[model samples]
Target: MMIHTEPGIIKRDGVYFCSSDSFTQDNLFYILWGAVYSLDSPYRVSRSYMDAFMLQYIVSGELNFVLRGKTFTAKANEAVLLNCREKNLYWADRQAVVKWFHFNGKNTLPLLNYIYERNGGTGLFKKNYTKKIEPYIDSILNEIHKKDSNVFSISHNIYSILCELSAPPAVLESPAEKTIREALSFIQSNYSKSISVNDIAAHVSLSTYYFTRLFSKYMHLSPHTYLLSTRLEAAKKILIYTFEDIETISLRTGFQSSSHFIRAFKKANNITPNNFRKVFYQKSID
Candidate 1:
């Protein structure tokens, strides 16, 4: 497609860059990109970043992932779904080779659900594992290679991979509690700045005292506690996605001062903001 090469990204021999066409694919529901990684490659998840969910397949050697305080290892011919909403570290062994597909679209959730349901409510590699699933994996790659906008070949491939991985749907079916949901929604949308319980309660048309009680009962904390989590999450995103400093981040995330931001971030995430960024960058090979 006459795509231009960019610095800082590893391009596979056969895979094409999709960033240029990403905007055109908004109607695309989701996007897919393929890449092969060599051993000794370290890919760290961005701090405070949330992925749409991903699938990884080991073509050869082995890969290790540290996710949410646990370690997962996948060997050749095996595939796994990378979970969402967590900062993670992934690395390939000295001899490892891997092919990964990053997929996200309108039917992404549905596709994952279908796979999980088909696999008896578990994720992939649960049964007697075999190396013969390569053909199925190849089928997905072939579909993505089509790169057609009229038909939904890419979506189907993502659906099939979800089937192979047996990914699960969200466990939270309904909103936890009315007040809590409102508060959470407020936090997510407005976390770029300081917010207060009174502001949230007013948005939901409830008194502060009553709303605070309801928030604690359902959310297990007062509104301020939820705000901290939301603000921290936003701060993490800023650190990873942007190159702004602590003062900027503090103001953007509603912290009254940089000192306040540092204290809160260390308490919640167990690392200073600068250290978090340093560790995250250290993980990325590029």
Candidate 2:
């Protein structure tokens, strides 16, 4: 495929190209190239005819596309896949970044057709469903860079991702489910803030009582417990990777105080923050 109209990206973006033998081409789904690109708005692709299926997961900003006489937009956390051989057009309508790839295989086109038909002739996957498959895509992206690419495993993962895309609920999402999804996304973004259950419920426009019931029903954890778990996880990473003081780490991770942080961490991990750090350091030295 030709990059027919790119002024250039705003930042340095990296990509890897993969080559496969005849057996792989005949048997496995294989990546042609993949990258995490921070693209400029003026970037566009109208040229076609290189035969492959293009899949992109938007990380930020927006992308607009015209495929099979239909137009669509992919926002952050959404995904789009289409046949590259079609008379299609797609561009970054705003400054956008994505984890994307062009892949080819014996059965790729058939799988794409199934996925499009399943979604009523569209390839856009909503944020909720795409979340389920990002880890598999991450694996494929990492494997494509290895000295000896695991073609079989990559093929399985690509097939798994496609299979997931091909299966959305009969009805896209229920109102309750959508509410919970929005709440989860909000928590991911705001977990570093000193936010409470009330704050979270307010953000989602629900009463605290109802929201707590719904959150527990869906996630099997109370909002308070989940929030504390998020903070503790962040503190653990800090303890292992940085020399930041425990108090600073506690405050930054949204804990009310260092003592509270220590108590919670020990309850969760059976070890204090300082002891955890020392153990990690000792392991590295050993």
Q: On residues 217-240, what C-alpha lDDT tens digit does candidate 1 reach at each position?
A: 887778888888878888898898
Clashing pairs in 2: none
Clashes of each: 4, 0
Per-residue lDDT tens digits for candidate 2, residues 29-140, read 9889888888777888885677888888988898898887799998999988878888788887678888888899999988888888788676788887789888988998
Stretches of model 1 off by over 4 angstroms after superposition: 1-11, 18-29, 41-47, 110-133, 143-151, 167-286
TM-score of 1: 0.42
Q: TM-score of every model?
A: 0.42, 0.59
How far off is residue 79 in model 2, in Å? 0.3
Candidate 1, residue 275: CA error in Å? Answer: 88
lDDT of 2 at 279: 100
lDDT of 2 at 235: 85
